[model samples]
Target chain A: MNYSNFKIPAVAVALGASLGGLVYGYVNEAISLALEAATPYVEQGFEVREDNWSGEVEPGKPLLVKHQLFRGNEYWFWAGTSWPGATIKVDIFDSEGNSVGLESFARDSFAGVRALPQKTATYLIRVVAEYSKTGEGLTDEERGANDPVEGVGEFSGSLDWGLVYGYR
Target chain B: MVMIENVIRIFGRAPLAGLGAVFVATLIFGAGLLNAENAPNAPERIDLSNFPGEMVEKVVVPIPAEIFAVLEKLDEPDWNSGIELPEQGDPVGERAILALTFGSLVGEGFIAVQAKNADEIQTIGKRVLALSEALGLAAAVRPHSLSIIEAAGNSDWKKVRDELDATQQTVRTTMEKLRDDELSGLVSLGGWLRGTNVVTSFISNSFSEDKAELLNQPGLIEHFRGLLDSMKGPSANSPQIRSISTGLARLEAIIAPSTEISEEDINQLRDISRTMLEEYYFEKKAAETGTSIN
Candidate 1:
C-alpha cells in the first residue's frame, strides 16, 4: 500500500508512451512521402480541379466515400499509410451493394484502383490497410510457422492512414 | 478487482516485494507498447470482413473538365457557344462577391480552354488575377495566371488549360488552409453553377439519351446541397447561397432517385442554373438577365 514504490515505474511507463508517440510522428512523415510517391503515377495525364479529400483509416477498418463518377471518364483513387509493412485494399461498389472493383498494388505503403464507370452514377469507394511486419507477403512454408522472420531488425508499427483521388 | 485488492494487501506486508512487482509490471507494459512501436510484432494482413467505414462530411465534386473530357471523346462539340468571355463591369468589390467571382472566373477559364481561344484564356487569366488581387489572394494565384498567359503565348492550349486549373486550385487551397471555409464553399458553388450552365446548354442542344443521361448528377447536387447545409456564418447565410440552395433543390428534385431525364427537365434545370449564375456571378437582376453569364 506504499505509494512511494509505484512512483519510479509509473514515471518510466508514462515516459515510454511519450517516446512511442514521438517516433510514430516521424514514421508518419515517412509514410506521407511514400503516399506522395504514388501521386505522379496516378496523375500523369490528369488535370485535377477539385480539393484533395482524405480521411484516416485504421488496420482492418475499411473507409468508404461515395462519389458521382460519370461514365466515359477515367478516375483513380490512392490510399496510403505511414505505417511501414502495411498493405492497403480499396474496393469500388455499386448502389446495389455489389463489389465492382479491382485494386492496383505498389510495393510501398500505398494501393490504388482506377475504374471507368459504365453508368454515370454515384459509386462507393472502400479503402482499408492492414499492418504486418512481413506484409511483403508470406511463403507457403512461412505461413505454416508462427514466427516467419528468424532475425528481424525492428518491430512493425501501425497507425491511421488516408486516401486521395482525381479525374482528368 | 478483488484479486488485485488482495495482491495489494499482500504487497503492503512486503514493501520490497511490492517494489519489485511494480517494476516488473511497468517493464512488461513498456515492452508491450514497444512491441506495438517495434516492427515484427504488428499484424501483417488486413481482414476487411465486417469492416464498417464512416462517412467523411467534406465532398469534392468532380470538376467541369470531367464532363468536358467525355464530350470531347464522344463528339467534338463546338467551343464557341460555351466560350463567351465574362464581362468586367461595375467594379465596386466585396469579399463575398470576390469569393464567388474567383470560382466563376475559373469556370470561365475552363470554357475558354474548351473553345481553344488563347485570347479569351489570357483575358480570363487577367480577370482571375484581378479577382485574386481584390481578395488579396494574388500571391497564391499570381504565378498560375502568369503561367497561363505565357502558355497561351506559345499556343500551348494544353498547358494553358492546366495553368488555369492550377490557378483555381491554388486559390481554393489557400482559402481552405487559411480556414476561410465560407469563401472556399462559394468558390466551389460559383464554379459548379457556371460549369453546369454550359454543360446543360451543350446537352440540351445535343438532346440525345446518351447526353441527357449525363445530367443524372444526383450525387453532385446532393454534395452541393450538403455543402450549403454545412456552411457557417456569412457564407452559409448569404442571400446568394440561400438562393443557390433553393435553385439546387429545384435541380435535385428533378434528378434524384430517377434513372432518366427528359429534354424538358434538362432545359428547366439549365434555366435554374443559368438564372442563379447570372444573379451570383454577374450580379445581374434575375429578370434583366436570367441567362448564363457571358
Candidate 2:
C-alpha cells in the first residue's frame, strides 16, 4: 500500500478543517457575547431620585420629586426646592392617569418633607413650582411672569424628574 | 491473473469510495446543522436608528413623567387653589398611587438589573412592556374615575361615589394583574421592555410638546384604560421575574422620599444595590451552566 500520498493529504485536510471549525466557532461566539453584553444598557431606565429636579409648593399637595436616588423607586414630598414663605402645589396621578392624590406645602425649603412610596411606575406627578415672593400674592403680571421671583434663584426646569423602569 | 485478483480484492475490501461518501455526508450534515443554528444571523442589528428615536424617547421619558404625574395628582387636590392639606383625596386613589408607584419602581429597577447583569436589551424591553401594562391598568380604571369626576363636575355626589366604587373594583383587578406580572421569562422580558421603550418615549414627547401635562388629562386616562383592556388575558409569569424581583423591590423602596437619607446615604444604597446585583449574576451563571438559555 502506498501510504505516503493518502497519509499526507489526510493529515493536511484534517488540520485545515479543524482550524476552520475553530475560527468559525470563535467568531460567532464572540459576536454573540458582545451583542448580549450591550442589551441591558440599551434598554435600562434612569434611577429617578430627589436631586433630579427642583420645585415650589403651593398650599396644596406638595411637589413630590419621585426620584430614583437610592433605587429606581418613586418618592413624594411636599415641595422640592423653594424660597421661604413660598406656596407650592403637588399633584399625583396613577398608572391609569387619574388624579389620585394631592398635597400642598408653604415653606422656604421642603428639606424636611416626608418620603412616600418609592415604587416607580408609569405614574406621572407634576409639581406646580409656584411661589409668592412678592409681599402680596402673585399679581396677574407677576404670576404670568416667566422670570423667577425677586431674591429667589431661577426655578425653571424644576419639574425635572428621573425616568425609572426596568429594561432587558 | 493473481495480480488482477489481488487488485480486485484490495478494491473490494478497502471500500475507499464508500468511506469518501461518508466523509462528504458528515461534512454536509454537520455544516447544515451549524448553518441552521447560526441561521438567526444576529437578529439583523436591530437598526434602532430606524427604530424611531422618537419612539424610544416617548417610551423611556414618559415612564418617569407618567409616574410623576400620578404622584403629583395624588399630592395636590386643586391646581387653582394653592392649598396644602395632609390628606384631601379619595382613599382608593391613595392605594392606586402606591401600587402604581411600586410598579414604576419595579420597572426602573428592572432596567438597572439588566444593566448590571450583562443581559440582552430585550429584557429591558419586556420590562417597559410590564410597566406599560401597569400604565394600561391605570388607564383602564380611569373611565370609572372620569365618571366620578364628571359626575362631581355636574355636582352629582351619589353618582360620583358609585363610579368610585366601580373604579375600585377595576383597580383591584389591575393590581392582581400587576402582581402576576412581577417579571418573568426571558422572551417576555425582552419583547415587552423593547416595545415599552418605544411606547413611553412616544407618550412623553407628545405630552411634553404642545406643552401638555398629562397629569390629569382625560385623553391619557382613556389611553391607559384602552391599553389595559387590550392586554388583560396575557400571562406574565416567567423565570426572569423571580431573578429580578428583589432588586426591583429595593429600587422601589429607594425611590420613596426619605427623611433620613442624604447624598451620602443615597450613594451608599447605590453601592449596596450594585453588590447584590453582582452576586445575582454569579448565582445565575452557576445555575445556568447546563441549561439552554433559550
Question: All models: lDDT?
Answer: 0.63, 0.30
Q: Candidate 2, residues A12-44: lDDT per residue as tens digits?
A: 334322321111112222112212222222223
List where candidate 1 sits over 4 angstroms from the true fold: A1-50, A134-160, A166-168, B1-51, B90-93, B283-294
TM-score of each: 0.73, 0.21
Predicted candidate 1 versus true structure: per-residue lDDT over A64-167, tens digit per residue: 67777777666666665544455665667766666555324444456556565767888877666676544347544334432436654233233445556656
Off by over 4 Å in 2: A1-79, A95-99, A102-107, A111-122, A133-168, B1-294
lDDT of 1 by residue, B190-242 (tens): 88778888888887777766667777888778777887788766656767678
Give the number of the best model, judged by TM-score. Answer: 1
Please list all clashing residue pairs in model 1, or write none if there are none: A131-B43, A132-B43, A132-B44, A154-B39, A155-B38, A155-B39, A155-B40, A156-B38, A156-B39, A156-B40
TM-score of the second chain, cand. 2 = 0.20
- For candidate 1, give the lDDT: 0.63
Per-residue lDDT of candidate 2, residues B1-294 (tens digit): 433332222223347654664466456434423312111111212232242211111211223223323323223212212111111122232222334332333333333322232122223223323333544554554454445445545555334333332333343334444664222122122222222332223233223211112221222223332333333332212232332344334433543432333333333333333333332221223322111110
State the displacement of the C-alpha of residue B51, model 2, in Å, after optimal TM-score superposition: 34
Q: Which structure among the candidates has the greatest lDDT?
A: 1
